[model samples]
Target: MLKESTELSMILVQNRQQQLNGNKRLFAWALVLLLFLGACSPKTRVLKSPDHRGGNVGGTIPKEEKPEGVDKEKTVEDARRAEAARNSVALILPFQLDKISPRTLLKEDVNRSAIALDFYQGFQLGLDELAQEGRSFSLNVVDSRDSEVRNQYVAKSEEISNAALIVGPVFPKEITSFGTHLSNKNVLQVNPLAATRAREFNLPNLVSLTPSIDVHTKAMAERVARDYKTGDVVIIYNTSDNDGRQFLNGFLSELRKVNSSAQVRSVSSVPQLNEEISLTGTNLIVAGTTDRFQLRSFVSNLEAKSSQEYYVFRVYGHPLWERIDFSIYERFGDFRPIITAESHLKTWTREAKEFKENYYSLYGVSPSDHSYKGYDAARYFGNLLAKYGDNYPEHITKEKFEGLFSAYMFDYNESWGFVNKAVSFKSYQGSSFQLN
Candidate 1:
């Protein structure tokens, strides 16, 4: 069995170094190539399709057209008919293929190009599974480098123009550039990456798989409203940061809708926190700032209060609390620390275990969060396209899909298109993370 949090925690720890060095993109590339190379005996090998028909092997797939009025057997004819009507899913990602050479693969290139390969591999697995269910997919894979010219070229292609669903173009700017061309069309664009919701690609058909900061806070507020009825909630915010203020505003809006009597407090020190915590029923403390110093202070003070507290104090903190020394926060007794996550993998599940086994067999290593994300994205969109045909968006919310590492429960926004409202609530229990 996969060690649930340890593996994920280690990956996060390793990712931080890459993130700080401005090389996290490269880190993902490195991990992907490491897995890919492990599958092969020799350094250089051409990746090919099982069937005779050609596919994009770290390159573009040439567009194939069906012959007009072609004669065929009944089975072949039915297959052809299904193929012609299959949903076109255009996957636009930054492969950076020109930087990579199978003959002379460098350590740095692997680091830089791993994300595209990893996502592609997992997506392929998902598509393969869908094929078993008689689902036809017209996949148009394009490499959109971090250049406007590349994005522009791909956006103008017939494959993309005629596509029913667009999977990526990972970065926010590229999404905007590609979406700008297809704004008038009813193409359902999926932003599989990026946490920030870009203003440029706020079209009705664009769906963001990664929920925004505001979305995270809103979900937390809703959960608090529904669950903590006995508590008198207090939102402690910092006055300096505009983003923090924005989060505070959203939290207050949601809090008012449910618990209209909840109080908002702007406190910076231990003395002020003590003053706020003196009188309460069951106190629901919300740390509204993302500042590390502020977080540390609040956490330390809260820990100090555990000895003398009469009423129950359950903490609901910002997601940035993950970056802090959790060893200290974990020391606090009965502190139900709640935070929102974009995606949370339940590795204990049979589906997850199966996916891990398949992945390890193929790559010689356990799968990471990115690998699971790719699988989920492909499974979700491919299944939807097969079931609903070209009009899949019309029936998006009809079914709810629980994937290996993610959940799909989308709510359509007129300005920002389809935003995934699903977020995982994790509580720090027994010095470990557990889904609540």
Candidate 2:
């Protein structure tokens, strides 16, 4: 079991790096952290902290650019006219309708349905919230789990073809395939989940709801450069794998943009990592390994080497650390680990509290992080569609959006279509995460 888990971890790391490099497809399973969500019991919990603001506010504002061939005056005028008419937003999800029947279904089938239903529930809430703001739009949900023939039928269907905004078609192949059919359309095609840079496809209207790898890595690098003195930072990475090398190189590139002389080190194993012993100065360690075995060994070695000191041995680690047994490594007060996040769930806020309560009331179970993500994505785009009409993509990067669970700041990359650049950092403080 441990070997299987570690193997999966390595694959995930490789997949993430491939997506970042535009060499391979993004890890589609990332949209649903199935194991994590399924293992936890459904229970409502609130985070009570002496300091209400847990983490550092993380957001990036991209410089606005004029949408090519778009006449601004005419677009706004058309938007105003659209406000009086009905707009449609289509959601394509993997509901696997054909598999669900009178026969006993497999465990995977049930789980997929649960995830889709949760996202739908949250999306409906977002629509309701938008409706309250005097914005009206027709909701169209399409199941992407059907046969490729049906999907092709959906691509040409009026429900999708006429949508002011189209969300989901979760898998990369599905998204890119749908995009191929809608290539000439002016409608917005939203990759509502995952961090995939579907660059291989020639999709002009494509945009992702989640931030990309470049955004997260560059943001984390910028944060480190801003917070700490250049001389005190050191990035330690594994040199054995392509993913490790990619992360190490990308992080160094971003760090160099801020501090040209920032130091870096590469180690393939614990034996190679034995050379470091500095403890007097405030040390910042940026770990680049995403493999479970490597991380476990690295943390164990670092933890064993630590001693009491006024300044802690601060580690800026990978997000996969949260999925593994990271709590055991946080035993010493002198050692701290920080992980970057696309969203930080604020349980104390009124909006969050109400959403959770309402979700629980409706489903009889506590919502997972994906639910919050779904709601935020729906609300953010819905608001823009209401104001900007079919040309919402033109003004999407114009304003900063502070969502209940995330902050939306978009930048249109010619090579990778539109990307969200907002990123948040969080540290495990006792039972919940605090902004770092």
Candidate 3:
């Protein structure tokens, strides 16, 4: 099942050499490797031991060869001591290796495994950096297969039981299922990707890295409240969909908290919203729908109406608006829409440039959002483990990190565990979106 150390330099070097042929070939090679890796059975792949030296090793931990006169008890004791001293971290991801078949493998299959592969590569790079800085860790990578039964089984494994920190099981349902089976309440399980609210899971030891939708709503609402004026009217364009309504409700609740008497109205159509807008005062338009079609239609129609009448307005959009290409719509720029982003990597910055260079050098490809997230997660939590040992969770709230993609400032919730409150608000300025 490819139980191996994080010493992936040899493999990377070989891949990089092949990549020099052409960019197209390089990507093809990467996909091929991903498919190959995904064909393996789910098993625990252990990183190299702190004491290990010389060549890279793979497969299951070999049986220790004892000398004829060596005392078995003493050897066992020493092994236990070494294990106890070294920090153990486990990463549980849905590689879904079983889904890949030799005869039926397609580009779609490779794409399915890409998220796990990208994250793993970035995570390995982070660990490599830690190792270079003289931090020792025993990393265990296990495939969750995105199965509830599999998660339950893996949760009870020795690797999970011994781990000081567990990094994944990416989806919300998987996180809940895995957490349910985990017996060790002290071990911190990180929800690396999911944007689901922490309170829903009710996992006391869970650390949610992604800020929830409610956080985005509150952040946007607070910004609106801060800049609010007496004559300015706040109008919400909401849909009947639960997601749209959730943002609408959350924003209203937070806005009311700051300005109890704020002039606010909710409308379902562009025409109704246009009627509420005044030419004299600034109209704060909150687009509460995450649906791309509705957003496009609403924005286009409102922009046309506003431009024709010369109405003063600014738009606040749902978090999902980050996915939409507003630049494509010629009228969107005029609205000067502001939206919440979970993470924003300034690629022009020195740190980002170096990260991209290093990532490309090693993986022979550009880093994706998952890759950045993985690197940050590994580096941040690995540092915490090195500094705080088993008591890392206690210090999580106190430790703040600004990584390549995301900035983390956790607030400890007694019921929901550590929830990252960090969120970025970006505004459409000139040709592109910039941090507000």
Candidate 4:
């Protein structure tokens, strides 16, 4: 269904444009009437919530700037979008830069300091680019570790209320308090790491960079339908692990959204999948576990059976794909694994690659998806702060920005909560991952 959905988008957009033109003459007449009324009116007409765009209208360009090789007219249009893009990002306040004990996660390995610096390092890279482009940055590194005073919550609220974009305290409790508080402030509070199921909100300003359960699950299911449209889908999980449960929930959610009415199967242990696999004519499996031993065992069994059921056999999972030794991919031999990570290896920023290679060279082991995730989150939003700063709402709010970590599309739903604005799919097709 999504395959078709993606193809139909251009048709839909053109139909919308045709509808917009239908009322152009009427809009012109209305504008003339408005001008006539303005001449006779005692005060300028005022109505709240006027539509900002659309309709036949004329005015001076919204912004003006020099362009690379464009004439004056095109430069004006480019300037408007550039200004709008610059304004869309929000400014997240860090914990007080002067206050709080700077307690960093000490590196156990030799390259701890270098690896740890990555988050701030990537963020500064964005900041440096914006400054070179002649943009001003108004960033405040608040001491997030500050102890809260009860009455002072209001004062703290006032201090941050003006900030259109807020990054995070990166702790569950801090996220809860600030999330609840800022949900009302029209400011976005993005939590890079501390994604726990504390509560849900309808805040226009609040968006989670990570998919909680629903988005991940649904996407996994959609990919399943596409990859194995005729197959019986099985969800295998370890009952003990929380990640297993979270991923299983997501897999089932995705299955429900697919266009075809496919058979869905489930089981608790590896032994159960072995038996269930025999019964399901086609098996598309999701191994949802972060534990390496469990995942390895699961992979070994599934790979042994791949030749028997692979016409529609596919295996999928979460960011846990990062934790397991990737060299094991060749070990799996015939059976390929599909990991649902944020993005592909090549999708990393230039600094991201440098950090990864350098991190591996120093630490031996590579960084986990979560590590890059944190690096990307900090880098992305930190750059947002460094660029738009205070003027975030005017530009960032209206446009969807796709970046290294996640796609920052401000979409929300009343029932399911904020769908993770961005997610990329990659599959380990028995060897290296192939991005879809």
TM-score of each: 0.79, 0.75, 0.85, 0.60
Q: In candidate 2, where is summed lDDT lowest over 10 consecutive residues? A: 40-49
Top TM-score hit: 3
**Tens digit of per-residue lDDT, candidate 3, span 1-436:** 0223333444555566554445454455445444435445333433332433333344644358544323554464466345434568888888776776665656665577778878887887787677556566667778888888889988898868878889999988899999988999778899999999999999999999999988888988998888779888998888877768878777888999999888998888877886788777788888778777887788788778776887877888877777667776777887778888888788889999999889888776788999999999889998898788877888888989999998899999878899999998888887667777
State each model's CA lDDT, in order. Answer: 0.66, 0.63, 0.77, 0.48
After superposition, which runs of candidate 2 have C-alpha atoms over 4 Å from their true positions? 1-85, 103-107, 146-149, 200-202, 239-246, 276-280, 308-312, 330-333, 431-433
Better of 2 and 3 by lDDT: 3
RMSD of each: 9.3, 16.2, 5.9, 18.5
User: What local lDDT does model 1 show for residue 317?
Assistant: 69
Residue-wise lDDT of candidate 2 within 1-436, one digit each (tens)?
Answer: 0011122223334444333221122112322233222322221111111222233333643436444323454454355335523467778777665565424444555566666656765776677666655555666667776345556667887667666788877777787767777644677788877677646555767887777666667887886777676446464655565546655557877877997776656456677655643445556777767776777777777777664434346777665545655665566334566777877777798988999886665444467777887888878888887777767788987867887787888887666577778878888676444676
Error of 1 at 307 (Å): 2.3
Specify the poorest-scoring 10-residue window by lDDT in model 4: 42-51
- Highest lDDT model number: 3
- Judged by lDDT against the true structure, how good is candidate 4? 0.48
For TM-score, candidate 1 versus 2, the one ahead is 1
Model 4 lDDT at residue 172 = 53
